[model samples]
Target: MISRGNRGNALEALVAGLRGTPTDRADWQAVIALANRTLLTPDLFSSLARAGQIHQLPEDVREYLRFVHDCNRER
Candidate 1:
């Protein structure tokens, strides 16, 4: 079982892998896993920003969130 304390490091590793060697299928899988876990954390937005992971966010997910944020701001 993956421990909670380790999630941050795992996320870091996954982000690093995605940035440095995105061609690896395993790295992509890790990215997916991290994104899933991020959904449960309120800090995801800030963590992502601090890590500069927003750019690395999967295109569809990032775009969808951006669209939602834009819509909300216009309301």
Candidate 2:
């Protein structure tokens, strides 16, 4: 099983990876969402997504994640 610390480290690494492959907007958006949720800063994901720099997340997984975040925040 993955340790909690490892998961945190992996998410941070993914966030850092964004700076390198910034061309993959979809991936970046997904990564941003993951980072935001994991780090508990949901607005950062939406803010970055709306910024038009990273294209909206296309994958169902990413969309569902955003939906969950939205619903949780609304509650």
Candidate 3:
């Protein structure tokens, strides 16, 4: 869960991750949390996929992103 007093920005984490910057699991967690909160998870996932970066992510993360994107597309 994201702490209220956290100094790290979630959007920054997302952008950094998408930029191919080295990010830890914590950073990806934060980005997913924020994207879910903002209802941007599907879009973010699509961006990664379209950019060919989806294959770079861990299998679990890719699965989660695909699940979220599929859910959104079904709506």
Residue-wise C-alpha lDDT for candidate 3, range 1-75, written one tens digit per residue: 677644266677676555545245435677788878888788777888877777777788779989999998998
Across residues 1-75, which tens digit of lDDT does each residue of candidate 1 receive?
455655655676555543443322333344445755665222333445455666765676556545544554576
Clashes of each: 0, 0, 0
- lDDT per model vs. reference: 0.49, 0.50, 0.73
Q: Of models 1 and 2, which has the larger TM-score?
A: 2
The full ranking of all candidates by lDDT, starting with the best, is: 3, 2, 1
Highest TM-score scorer: 3
Inter-residue clash pairs, candidate 1: none
Q: Show model 2 residue runs off by greater than 4 Å.
A: 3-9, 13-41, 53-56
Q: Which candidate is the best by lDDT?
A: 3
lDDT of 2 by residue, 46-71 (tens): 55455553243446644654675688
In model 3, which regions exceed 4 Å deviation?
Answer: 4-9, 17-26
What residue pairs are clashing in model 2? Answer: none
